[model samples]
Target: MSFDKFVKNLSEDQKKELLMVLKESTDTDNKVAPKLVPKIEDGSFTTSIQKKQTEGETFGVPVTEMPRFNKFEDDGSDHKDKQNATPDVELTERRRPPFKKITQTCTRCDNTVETHPQFYREFYICDRCLKK
Candidate 1:
């Protein structure tokens, strides 16, 4: 029997009892499952206690001083020849690789045509047939 017909066969008291049982089952399921996240109250969560900081430890080795940030000194002993060297020639024109075309028969028109691999894979139709 259909769900509508089965529900229609139930009396008024039986329908009320079924609804009560469904509501209790859902409430018990929600209470039994563990909460994934903690609930926040008054717009803030509980803060954790901070641990004490220890000094003079670098990769488990005791160092006398910490490294300074953004400080670099140049002694000018390295790259002395490269600074005075000059290039002989330089190209002024931009170069690009040639496009690769594949021959495939058009799905729409049976004529064989050359097209890029990407266009053939996407539409499987030639440019002339696609424009038409």
Candidate 2:
């Protein structure tokens, strides 16, 4: 059945019991509650670009000169240098251990098994409880 229909079918006593269970499971005084307004005042957050622009500073370097490279002429000197160079260091590859699965117990069943916790809320109820 749909959640709304199931909830509506519950008696007054059942509803009160569910509410009591939920209230007991949660932490009412959590410090991570979201703020309604920003901590800083208006126009307080400034970026580097905005600061530089305000001071009339240029953004990037001017392209006044171009780079030059030497022309390649093969005289077998590079090959001779490679042959003369000796191995200074050795490198070894490392292997990591395989991941192991973690198991959690269902709060309702009190058994050691994988359990799905409620999203955006506290409490773990196994598949058996969920079906009910």
Candidate 3:
């Protein structure tokens, strides 16, 4: 309706009553309204939620403690030898093959490398391999 027509039809008391009823309905709307909290997904892969942070904390903190090596620290200073220092003399020993000084004889060439006891059992390797 036009302003003049509406004012003409609505008495002052009727207009006041209508305004009050409208305000009341608007107020009641708040009570019936649903909250808009975010639907926090469980953040889980298989229905298992990973704890991002403790209850009292708002954010997660990373563990930083790890192993560290220091060169200067030493408990046994008397027994410790300097890495850059070298000894006055050295003792050397020669290494030998797995088998040596075989009194055994080769079955093919009759070479005296067989007739040994509790050995690798390298019974024969010459004549047969040469034939092959």
Candidate 4:
């Protein structure tokens, strides 16, 4: 019989005993397995610098005690005394040069034209004969 069918046929006491046995097996497996730790140094198994930094009290300062600047507050000063008070030159957006069209002969018609290549069986043809 299938496991689900067998489980369904079991009595309440039998189900309880089966669950207890499964729990005990898992507990024994955990106890028998060895816990693994990654090796760091070539000479000794010392704790990493990152671990030391995280554990030490001197590594970091509280955010409330850190230095900060007030961005909104501006000290008032005379504008005329400052150098380059007004800009002499104006800035403008640059325009790109137009694309240069290339001419090629169509394989089917032997016509010279400046247009995108149209695909034939294994060769390129001009637009006029490509439809045929």
Best by lDDT: 1
Q: What are the per-residue Cα lDDT tens digits for candidate 3 across 2-55?
A: 877986799899999988998999999978988776655757445546677744
Instruction: List the candidate 1 regions with Cα displacement exceeding 4 Å.
Output: 34-132
In the order shown, the candidates' Cα RMSDs to the true structure are 26.3, 37.4, 19.9, 26.6
Q: What TM-score would every model get versus the actual structure?
A: 0.25, 0.21, 0.24, 0.26
Write model 1 residue lDDT over 6-114, tens digit each, in one string.
9999999999999999999999998898767756676766777766655633463444465634447888877669667676887678587778999888778877878
Comparing 2 with 3 on TM-score, the higher-scoring candidate is 3
On a 0 to 100 scale, what is the lDDT of residue 11 in model 4? 100
Clashing pairs in 2: none
**Model 3 score (lDDT):** 0.64
* Alpha-carbon lDDT of model 1: 0.76
Candidate 4 weakest lDDT stretch, 10 residues: 115-124
Clash number by candidate, in order: 0, 0, 4, 0
- Worst ten-residue run, lDDT, model 1? 55-64
lDDT of 2 by residue, 12-116 (tens): 999999999877767554645877975566776874454436333344645445343446788876646767887788877668765554466667887555423
Instruction: Tell me which residue pairs clash in candidate 4.
Output: none
Candidate lDDT (C-alpha), each: 0.76, 0.64, 0.64, 0.72
| Best TM-score among the predictions, by candidate number | 4
